[model samples]
Target: MLSASEASIEAELKTKGLNAPRLTPADIDAAIVGEDFHVFPGTTMTVCALKLRNGFVVIGESAAASPENFDASIGRRIARDNARNRIWELEGYRLRSLLAANA
Candidate 1:
């Protein structure tokens, strides 16, 4: 479902004059400063760096949420994703350690 939504959005972006760049995982990792992962009940939240065309980068949240009672978990994931994005922009290496430690 999430992949479908992502594809839908990507298609929409192309329609809106945005092109999808072919980015490798290594390129994405090189552009990323940090990430945050959270799990709650039946949901999983992951925030990571996404490299776009023309050297642009954005933070992306990949979530797997339960069909029922999704609001809370979804909202939490959004908030966390936003916060992590900000923190990554500021404290570049803090999240790197956390990510590596987890790995």
Candidate 2:
């Protein structure tokens, strides 16, 4: 969950035409996992990749373990954030190219 301030920042960014992808807890929970998409665990980090139906692959990674934060939930959130960031970047590029072509 985003704090009030964080949500406001995100809203401001979006209003400025920034490409931002927001994923709720429910969205993360409902994320599909199979041969095409899955989380890969490493010794120091966890990497997750989702293969979209449209053949786009979004990847994310997070620290596997932290001394100060032992909760797995934090890592999961980080991974999801990373994934969404990648998605936003790709979408932004696509949109730019599309607008350029239309112009």
Candidate 3:
């Protein structure tokens, strides 16, 4: 069952006509900047790179920090969300073009 947040996200994607291809951890290359508890006191930054089947590459970066410690996954999730938002923006243009054609 999809959680409320998941359902909402799905609906938003569908409404925007943004369909993202499946991406696995292996398909994404991640780079972490600022060592946890070393370089950055309590923050971690991650940059994720994904190569699309269309021969285009998209990169996203995010920084996250917790009160007690730094969570690497948090940064990764933020970066992934950033990349998805970029994809949505690109897809929006395509949707506009399609609408213009059909009109």
Scored by TM-score, the top model is: 2
| Location of the lowest summed lDDT over 10 successive residues in candidate 2 | 29-38
TM-score order, best first, reads 2, 3, 1
What is every candidate's alpha-carbon RMSD to the true fold? Answer: 12.5, 6.0, 8.4
Is 1 or 3 the stronger prediction by TM-score? 3
State residue 100's C-alpha deviation in candidate 1, in Å.
25
Tens-digit per-residue lDDT, 1-103, candidate 2: 4557667876787689876344433343344342122344434465667665456667787874554654466666677667766665666676678778978
> Which is the better candidate, 1 or 3, if ranked by lDDT?
3
Give the Å shift of residue 73 in candidate 3: 1.6
Error of 3 at 63 (Å): 1.3
- Between prediction 1 and prediction 2, which has the larger TM-score? 2
Candidate 1, residues 1-102: lDDT per residue as tens digits? 134655676577768976533432234335555444444455555454534334454555655455454454565567545544543454345555666787
Model 2 misplaced regions, further than 4 Å: 1-44, 64-68
What stretches of model 1 exceed 4 Å from their correct place?
Answer: 1-70, 93-103
The best candidate by lDDT is: 2
> Residue 41 of model 2: what lDDT?
42
In candidate 3, position 63 carries an lDDT of 69
> Worst lDDT window (10 residues) for model 1?
20-29
